[model samples]
Target: MSSTISDPASDGVVRAADGTPLKQRLNRALRREKLRSFLLILPLLAFIVLSFIMPIADMLFRSVENQIVEETIPLTVVALKEWDPASGEAPGEEVFAAFHADFVQAFKDKKHTRLGLRLNYDEPGMSGLFRKTGRPSTKMQPPYKEAFIKVDEDWGTVETWAVIKQASPAYTDGYFLNAVDAHRTAKGIEMVPENERIYLFLFGRTMFLSIVITMSCLLLGYPIAFLLASLPLRSSNMLMILVLLPFWTSLLVRTSAWKVLLQQQGVVNDFLVWIGLVNDADRLIMINNQFGTIVAMTHILLPFMILPLFSVMKTISPNYVRAAKSLGANDWTAFWKVYFPQSIPGIGAGAILVFILSIGYYITPELVGGTSGIFISNRIAYHISTSLNWGLAAALGTILLALVMLLFYVYDKIVGIDNVKLG
Candidate 1:
């Protein structure tokens, strides 16, 4: 009779049965497991690449892309290729003639001048140039040797052509420079004037605000988290629900409620006055400032800090502190040296979360701080919605994103983000 035999490589038994070699069968099983794991993770990998990586790449492209210039003045750009800026003489009239034709065509097209104006607005006074180029007088004139010059006398000046020439490139760092309160010149880079230098100041203020808010949340949330973690299960569950109650409310509602409560004529001020704590209600300045922003944001983000800390503290047994005390370490020393070090992961996680969220906060700062209280994001919003400067807006956004990423990198280096466990 034929006996069954195992196919060692395939982990399959033959009709002439015999056992497979252990190593080969184990390798086959491992290969199957690896294949199954890959299949299970394939969808997630595809989702991350398509949704996260691709969109970020596109945003980075937009941040540096200068399509308006490339599309608007193709002819002028071609004509000026041989023209040298250092020559100190005007480019040939052919350059002007090409620009004149382009301008006339753009005016006729109605929307074309807008592209030039938008591109030029980054450099200032380009809008006026577009307006002059679109004038009826320039449009009605017949072609002549000086017809281009007649369109705008300034067009002949080397300075005007130089601006146009410099802007002809497909990509530019102009927006990025401007966002950082700096700009490029013919000579090279230079600092912007103090009066107009808003971004650097705003960036500093945002960082300061984020740091303060993060610290405050840590100080206030740590005790509460400790209490929740140390308590029995039933009590901890009820307290956690209370702590998380803010999460159920909309952020906007919470901020608005603070505004009503903290206003000079609001409940808090009235209570203080009723309790004889303050001399005047007007002294209770709450809305339209940094204090309001910090208070509202701290309240909203406190739960984030608390939850992670509670999880970490819960996993840490009280016996460690007791064991330290038994070994002659004082209560404060034991808690500080033993417990605090272990909770670093939670601290890092909470701080990173709060700092990142604080940097991007718009509505709270806008509503509470008003003009003086606005952060970098408010300026970004204005540039996008009102000024219609996508380049500047994108540049500002890119800078904010970079700062947050840098913070993450630093935190990861210091505390090893890979080791951070939420539970």
Candidate 2:
């Protein structure tokens, strides 16, 4: 006789003595599987939190922070409680007295003076004010009001007091406003001067360049993606490897190569002149300009656009286009009205990826485009490293982040990000 095994589902082999259903045993197994899956995901969750989330949070904090105000004029901030921001006039003499005291103390402490100078470097005329206040001689006198009055005489003026009253708070929105081409005055909002304006221009240029490059990539990449998608699997894979070959090269090397290719004495210029395309080599404005940047960036970023499009195009059935053609639609109409619309997800994803990356790029623009073509990120880096102005750098970074977020939000609203299906 064959040995008979009890069926867990039918015979309830794991049932409790109280006669509970074998369903409980199945539930226990299911829960164990779920727990094991969660355990497997735990490390990834920790990695995301530690590596990405925490650093972003720290950066955001640094962007809007006002530590200088807190440390420099603690007493003034406390004393100016009665001063109303809405009233928009100078605070009482008591606020000035507190400032005087703080300045005197901070002046005596060389370290604190240096800290104040560093913090205020971004603000126009602040370096001078800090230097004046941070002097050792400025500390020797009790209540340095006389010295302060001598420097500007506005020290006693309502406007001077108003400026201090406005700036006295331990926290501020000043840096943020300045970063976005907006300025906060006693009256209202206004545009910054052209000479003083940097971020706004860079931001606009960055956006414009990114859009142009993305469009160029889309126009060029779409045909290539379609060709690859139509090919056999083996042929398509080979083509894909060729398309992705640029990724193996270093970014700097590629950019430098473009520089060499586009220069006045380079092959491109020689060909143009030889082919009688232009009367002179000087006619080709290829290097150290927007054209150079666009060419190099589009070349570097083309793979990003192509891969998504290729993946999307591959999934789309060729029969749909044929079906549309059979219904008497022209080939171009069938493609535009049927096939192209289906490729929207890939287009959106690739455009967004390239745009965001392009805006933050510094090296290519700095190297090939020169001072005239520098982006906001270049200025931010300069402020941090050369000027040693962390506050300005943070403020610039915050503005860039906000703009990128705004762009993402607008894109999401127009076409839901969730709708994107990447193979």
TM-score of every candidate: 0.86, 0.82
Q: Looking at model 1, report the run of 10 residues with the lowest lDDT sum.
A: 9-18
User: Which residue pairs in candidate 2 collide?
Assistant: none
Report every candidate's CA lDDT. Answer: 0.80, 0.75
Each model's Cα RMSD:
4.2, 4.7
**How many pairs in model 2 have backbone atoms within 3 A of each other, for residues 3 or more apart or on separate chains, i.e. clashes?**
0
Query: In lDDT terms, how accurate is model 2?
Result: 0.75
lDDT of 1 by residue, 1-423 (tens): 123543444444332223555557778889999999999999999999999988877767877887776676678789989898778877886776676677666777685557656656556766776776676534544443266566667666677667777778889888888888997766678878889999999999998988999999999999998899889999899888888788678988998999999899889888888888886724588778988888888998898789877877888988899999999999899999998998887787788878888999999998898666788999999998998887888889889989889988877885577765442
Q: Which portions of model 1 show Cα errors greater than 4 Å?
A: 1-53, 137-152, 280-283, 409-423
Model 2, span 166-234: residue lDDT tens: 665556676677677777666776778778787778888887888888899999998999999999999
334, model 2: CA deviation in Å? 3.6
Query: What stretches of model 2 exceed 4 Å from their correct place?
Result: 1-32, 82-97, 111-123, 136-139, 151-154, 279-283, 327-330, 403-423
Clashing pairs in 1: 3-16, 3-17, 4-15, 4-16, 4-17, 4-18, 5-16, 5-17, 5-18
TM-score winner:
1
